[model samples]
Structure formats: C-alpha cells, structure tokens
Target: MNTDYTAQEIQDLVSEVLETADENGVLPIVQLGHPVLRQRATAYNGQLPTQMLEELLEAMRQTMYDAPGVGLAAPQVGIPLQIAVLEDLYPIPESSALEREREPLEYFEIFNPSFVATSDRQAEFFEGCLSFDGFQGVVTRPADITASFEDREGKEQSRSFSGWQARIVQHETDHLFGTVYVDKVETRSLINESELWHHDDLDVATARRVLNF
Candidate 1:
C-alpha cells in the first residue's frame, strides 16, 4: 500500500471509500478516532450490478481475514460508510466437537445491515475491539435480533441472530456511528482501560525476553 498522501488525497480517499465500499465486500476499515467516523453517510443505492457486489464481498472477506478479527467496520479502517463485515457465530451447535468454548468468535462480512427488530431479552457480554486497542467492556444488548443485510451487490437478505451473534452485530454497528465498546461499558469492574495493553500481557515476550523487546 501507498501510505503517501497528497493535498488532493482526501477526495480520492472519499471516492475510493465509496466505490470500494460498493465493490470490496469488506474494504479496509478506518481505525477509531478518525474524524469522519461520527458522521452518518448515505445508504446504499440498492441496485448496483451483481458482479460488483461479488467483488465487494470478496474484498470484505479479505479485509476481515487480514485484520485478523472476527468482524470489522467501514469506519474503523478510515472509510466512513454504512457497512461492516462479519462472520456469523450464533447458529453453530455448541456441542459440536470442533466448537471453541469461550467468547462468541464467529466470522462475518456484512453490508448495509440493520437490526430489523430486537428481542425483549437482553444480556451483557465482555467485549473487545480492534479500534479501541486494549479496552474491553460490558455492553448490554438484545438476547436476539433479526437483522437484514444486502449482499455485495446490494440485494436484500435477512437472518435471525441470537446469543453471541446478536451482540457482535450490535457492537460493530455502533462503530459506524463512532462509538466504541468502551462507550457501552456498564461497570468499571469489567474494564481496565489503563491496562488494556501491556507487555506482560504477551506470554511469549514475558517468557522469552523480559528486556521489553
């Protein structure tokens, strides 16, 4: 990637962001604290070509994979758009032998998604974010949510999400509005922003070289 920026780059970035947001399934997300994150952009055109949609989906999938996270927001990488990419985690049978017992960590690559309606039920989860860096928080959300999303081409699709899956969608969506998980933290006990990132947290570094390498 070319990291260089020109005075005219803003227009290009914005143009690329919109075009990429339309073509790349999960184009790179801007990190938190980016100024444009808080502003809501226009919704999708709803009638883009299908081939363009597929490329967008593939780009999104690659974005999530490269970021090394279960989900990503359009704004998190630098683009200010109404989109995100995530892998679904809820429907998996917990009893499956391959299932990992821990936090909800399914993968997703969603675009222009909406929480159609949320269930009355709600729960709190210890959540983390790529943008916030090291802070974790307790965010309360519906136990289940029926969400609708468009495919890469802007076609309409929907799904019922509950448990961990519902929580993930709710969390990433907040990113579109410039909100971080830290904003939803209910109790100070569940979070430690000051200690979010520390060398001691890395097992390999601590055991191998205490010299702060």
Candidate 2:
C-alpha cells in the first residue's frame, strides 16, 4: 500500500516507534523532519533511574553499531535528554591521505556536553548523520576542541580531541544544541552517500574533484 504522510504524522509515528522499542534492544532513529531532531535537548539532571539510563545508553550503543555510524545522540532516537555515544575504534587506512594523522577513538558517552575551540585553525570535512540518512555534507569546524560532559554514572569527564575524533564529538554535541550538519553545510557540497562512497576515491581531494565541492 502507498501512503503519503505529512511531516507531523511522520514525526508522531517515529515517536511511537521509539516509545515501543524493545526493552533491551535498538530504538528507532528519528529522521530530519521530526521536531524532536530540531529542539535543543534538555540537560540530564541525574533524576532518571540509573538502571533505565544504563539500558538506554546500551541500546543507543547497539543502535549506533547497527547503523554502523560513528555516533548517535539521544535526540536522534526521540529522547530529549542530553546524551550521546560515539566510537571510532579502527584506524584510518594509510591510503586515506588526508586522515593518516587521525587516531582510533575508544567508545565513550557524554551527557550535557560542551566544547571550546583549542585553536583558531579550521578544517573542512564531509559528515553524515543517522538522522540525515543517505546524504553527506561538507562542514568546517575548529581543528581541535576540548569538551566536558557527564559520564553515565553522573561523574564529570573532560577530554581534548583532534582530527577525526574531534569531528565526531563536535558533530554529536551539535545535536544537543538543535544543530544538524545540513544547517552548516556549504550548499553546493551536499552529495548522496552512494555517489560519495561505493568507489575507490575516498579521500578529500577526490571528493572535491568529483563532487565539485
């Protein structure tokens, strides 16, 4: 059956699916048109049950892994809490010329995160989000950042990140502030994921050459 849903209907349907996610499994990821994806998420006040928070974070991690994305935010899953999970555990290959300096990032979670630019230097890269499926956009962000956030147990954790790791954290943190990569991308730089991937050219130079970004 073919059905055309209005934006509000789609948003409501996404919320319903998230609300009914398996108790110990992946949650539905809300897409671009949902209002929840556009709202600034509320800060975590350490009031929710610790057990519940644990399960949610675990489910978020599982969802992120299933989507095979570098990060996932609570808002993307239809939760307005200030929480996100990210990991870039594998190294960039030597063939990725622009990212050879990047290092592997261990799994981490952040709540109510905030960041400060450690350098005035800026860098541009293509980024994709679970919420903005099937498209990638070019965004320029500070080359280095230091961020602070609460851990799962309500303990404070502060860290500095650079290279791809810095990009991952900044992208996820922006979600908490109601900002998506589309909002900051160069208009001419958006490319469908299929055209950008599924080819031998995976470096910045090749991307700019072919996509004209």
Candidate 3:
C-alpha cells in the first residue's frame, strides 16, 4: 500500500472502501501481516472533504464497536492515515474497573494525534489489538498522558488522561507511528485469548510470575 496519498487519492480510496463495506458498515480490518500495519501512517491534512471524512470516520467507528475494542486507527483498516476513534464504557465488573483505574469515556474521533507522558508512573496490563485477534500480551505504558489532536470539526484540542484511558490513547497513537503492543510487550507474557481468563484476576506481578515473563 502507498504510504502517502493526495487529497483526491485519499477521497477515492475512502469512497471505495466505504462503498464496499459489509451490511453492518464495518470496513474489513487488515491483519497483523499486512504491510500497512507496519508502515508509519501519513498525517491527516484535509486530504478528504468534510462530508467524506465524516462518513469514513463513522464507518471506522462502527468497525471499532463491532470489533468490541476501545480504539481503532486508520492503518488497521488499510487507510494509512493519522486518524483514529476511541471510546471505553468500562464494560467490565466494577471491581475490575477499579483495579485497572478505568473510567467511562464517550466516543470521539481524533486526527493527527500525539501525546506526552505526564508522570513517571507506569502500569502494566494485557493489551490486545483488533489487527491481532485472539491474542494478548502484557505491555507497560505511561499511567498518565496529555494528548493533542484535532477533533472531528478540525478544532485543535489537548487534554490529559490517566489510568486506562491513557493506555488507550497511547495504544492508538502508536498505530499512527507503526508501533504495535507486541513490539513493546513482555514476549513471554503473550498468551491466547482463550487462556486470558486464567490471569484476569491476577495482579501484574503475580501474572508475570505465573507466566514466567
């Protein structure tokens, strides 16, 4: 896939993908081995018309929700653009949510997103990607961050996020730069999703010991 595209090229590409979407309007998510996943995504710069961009974002949002994931980036859908959508309603048990310092987040779209850690503190948790289904691994990330991005209206915005929200932002932003969780994960801690239940309740330290990572 080409790493860079002109405005018309992007519009054409997005149009084609959207037109061929499944009945649910979910675009096909490219998998781990796809070259697009490894290439740094091109920055967004009015390459798509307003309405077309909105349509593309809506489809990506549906795709993310259908995947049941907190976030999705353009590269995951083969667009290779610096755009992503994120939301986390904290669907897990209250106990688990509290354990992970998770809080509910409403859905939102971001373009040309970037972030910086706000604290030295870090947290480790099992992170999964829509691109790499049915597997997860322990990845440590900054526990807090301040992200800068353009909202759906192209307005520049900056905000701070902590705990699980911070992790989600970092994960999606990394996708724009061609980085995946597995690249930063404790490899020995990798496991099939079917086996994830065994470690769900364990703290990072305990999980690390049990997984020998």
Candidate 4:
C-alpha cells in the first residue's frame, strides 16, 4: 500500500471515503496508520461546495454519537479539514462522582479551531480516542482553556472550557495539528480501557501504577 500521501491527496481520498459512506450509512473512520491522520489539516476556507460541508458536519456528528465518543475530528473520518464536533451532554451516573464537575456541553461544531490556555492549573486524566480504539492513556492538559473558531453558520465563536470539556477541546484541536494524545503519554502509562479503574482519590503518581499494565 502507498504510504506517501500529499495533503491534497489526503483530502481527496477523504471525499472519496465519504462518498462511499453514503451507501453504507456511516463514515468509515481512518485508523492509526493512515497517512491522512498524520498530515496537518487545511484551514476551511469560506466555501461550501453544494452544501457538502454542512452534510459532512452532520454526518460527523452522527458518527461521533454512534462511536459513543465525546468528540470527533475531520481527520479521524479521513477529511483533512479544520472541522470537529463534540458534546458531553449525556447523563452521568451519580456513582461516577469524579466527573460531576464536568459541565455538560451542548453539541458544538468548530471549524478552524485554535486553543489557548487560560490558567496555569493543569490536570491529567486517562483519555481514549476513536482512532485508537480500546486503549487509554494518561494525558496532562491545561485544566482551563479558551478556543476560538467559526461555527457551522460561519460566525466566529470563542468559548472557555474547563475540566473534561477542556480536555476534549484540546484533544480534538491537537488532531488538526496531526498530534495524538498518545504522543504526550508515558509509554508505561498506556493501558487497555478494560483494565483501567477510577482513581479519583489517588494522586497522579499512584494512579500511574494503579493500572494493571
């Protein structure tokens, strides 16, 4: 298989993949080895070819919900464009008290999103990705962040996010830059999601060793 893919080629291939998905009903997610996932996504210019961009965004939203993931990036679906969808509005069981503080976010669509840290506070958590299914890794990210981007309607939007929402935005935004959360994780910190446990009371140091890796 050809591993070398130019940026344009990646985008074109994504379009093809999406076209094929129309018959299958869901966008086929590109996996870890795809060259498209490694290339920096192109900025979305103000152009919507036959409402294709809108349809793509909606499809991405559906794909995200189907994957049961909080966020999805264009690159994950093979479209190397600056687009992503995320929402954390699902009900959390009271037993998962650690996530109680994470504010529920309505579905958000960001195009050409850019992230900035708003505070010095930092937090680390075990995060999973749709691209790297079934695995989780510890990633330290800013606890508070503000991201600026254009909404689906092309209006500029900027919002601050903290807790899990901040991590979601940071993770998705990093995908646009061709970076994955695993890139920031210690090799020893990687674990299968099934083997992970809640470590709300444990310190970060202890949490790393708590997992039966």
TM-scores for all candidates? 0.64, 0.86, 0.95, 0.85
- Model 4 scores a C-alpha lDDT of 0.79
Two-way lDDT contest, 2 vs 3, winner: 3
Candidate 3 lDDT, 10-91, residue by residue in tens: 7888888888789989999999999988989888988888889888999999999898899999989988889999999846
User: Between 3 and 4, whose lDDT is larger?
Assistant: 3
Q: Write down the worst ten-residue block by lDDT for model 1.
A: 204-213
lDDT of 4 at 102: 71
- RMSD per candidate (Å) reads 9.0, 6.2, 1.3, 3.6
Which runs in model 4 stand beyond 4 Å of their true positions? Answer: 1-15, 22-24, 95-100, 197-206
7-84 in candidate 4: lDDT tens per residue?
556556656866866553578777888876787877776545636666787788888988889999998987777889
Model 1 residue runs over 4 Å out of place are 1-11, 14-29, 46-59, 88-108, 190-213
Please state the error at residue 179 of candidate 1 in Å. Answer: 2.8
TM-score of 4: 0.85
lDDT of 1: 0.59
Tens-digit per-residue lDDT, 52-136, candidate 2: 6676778889899888899999889877768899997654556563563467788999999999999997888778889989998
Better by TM-score, candidate 4 or 3: 3
For residues 97-151, could you state the per-residue lDDT of candidate 1 as single tens digits?
1322224555555666778446577665557777766556556677778887776
Ranking by lDDT: 3, 2, 4, 1
